[model samples]
Target: MTIHSSHPFLPPPEDRDPVRRLRGRLPAPVSVWTSSNGPIRGGWTISSMLVADGDPGELVALVNEDADWWDLFRKTRLACVNVLASRQSRVSEVFARVAPSPGGPFRTGEWVDSAYGPRLADAAAWVGVRLVDADPEHSGWGLLVRARIESVDLAEGRIALQHLGGHYS
Candidate 1:
């Protein structure tokens, strides 16, 4: 006797975080935050960020507290925020650890070393910053990163990559 259920075996979908799902709907820049601590180099893909205008200006971002990149960033307290181009989604995915980058993400991208850190050679724009560690609070799962914008570089007519709804927009 041969018997088989009409539906294929499958597990029910897991409950998704409403906050994360909702946040995903909002468009954000595809930025890579990079830092160099001595000989160690680290980078992380970050879209949870904001820019505040002031005398010195400020850029605040939420960073994964547990990420190795965060540890490296904390050491130097300085980093470069590089906004990727619209055509550089693969670079973002690589830095995000969502794609397989055999030699590492930096290996595939052109980079220029600066006072803050390594900045993407062809980024749409870049911001150099020094971390403000006044508050040690965690926002949800990320550590609240407040930075003083040290420098800014803008490239005209370049489209920046935007992420929304779990995909690039």
Candidate 2:
């Protein structure tokens, strides 16, 4: 699978480097990362995330430095990673800023307040995480954020959304 980077979600080749063709071959589950600074909340689509085995448990996620949610996440030092269902592509789009969503994106999904932040009620699963560290210097355009998993909520669901070849698979 080859993604030309001209793929709608990405910028043209000259303007933006092509996403690694191999990345399209490696399918990844779609998820939304949410953060709040008390009065305001924000979220965005994220595919660059993974869990790492450790004593206290941890997860790493790459967040675009330009995103407003990134700043909010830094201030809050907490977040919720919502593993999305296939039917929730629209939810993903809203956060990714691919489509317009009235009343803001949060209104499009059911939300529950959590110790770390907001959890997607209908997400396949969710993890509450507290920021452990952020390596901006080595992260390039995205901030490499490492977090300690504080909690997890699992729910029954089939058909999870996966990203592959520049499109949802």
Candidate 3:
């Protein structure tokens, strides 16, 4: 009676996981995860994030452990998820370390300080969050960070960037 049982080509229930092959099949929005604490500024391109359901609402980001943002995230315990506009693919590429931008990634995009952290000036939207927990050994991919949303800034942008099949869509 369920689609899962009817689809023979689908992965078995237990085998269904966030494996790269599976994730690659799903489209995820591109975002630049940024954080700062007066002195240090760090950011990286991320596609694994979501606004989770809860009181006060929450944002969860799965950050690679080797990313520079990891330490800044810990130091600040705060961050801003800047949802990229479709035209900002270059900015995403710079942060993803895929392309060279003059003066580096920070210089590739306009940035401004917000109450929670630094946010992209031209982002489609931005969500500020304060770290509630960080699980380092989660899913063998990266740190699982759950944060409480503190602020949100929605701007005017129609086209949003998405990542799928190893490319931006």
Which predicted model would earn the best lDDT? 1
Q: Which regions of candidate 2 fall more than 4 Å away from where they truly are?
A: 1-19
Q: State how far residue 7 of model 2 sits from its true place (Å).
A: 7.2
Residue 92 CA displacement from its true place in model 1, Å: 0.9
Residues 126-165 of candidate 2: C-alpha lDDT, one tens digit per residue: 8888888654444656778788988888787556789887
List the pairs of residues colliding in candidate 3: none
| TM-score of predicted structure 2 | 0.83
lDDT for each residue of candidate 3 in 19-93, tens digit (9 for 90 to 100): 767888999999998888776678889888888877889977777888877888877788888999878889898
lDDT of 1 by residue, 1-169 (tens): 5565743443433656678778977899899999997667899999999999998999988888876788778889999999888888888998888888887778868987888989897789999999889445898988888999999999788899999876785
- Pairs that collide, model 1: none
Predicted structure with the largest TM-score when compared to the true one: 1
- Candidate 3 segments exceeding 4 Å error: 1-18, 134-136
- Clashing residue pairs in all predictions, respectively, total 0, 0, 0
- Which candidate model has the greater lDDT, 1 or 2? 1
Span of ten consecutive residues with least summed lDDT in model 2: 133-142
Q: Tell me the lDDT of candidate 1.
A: 0.86
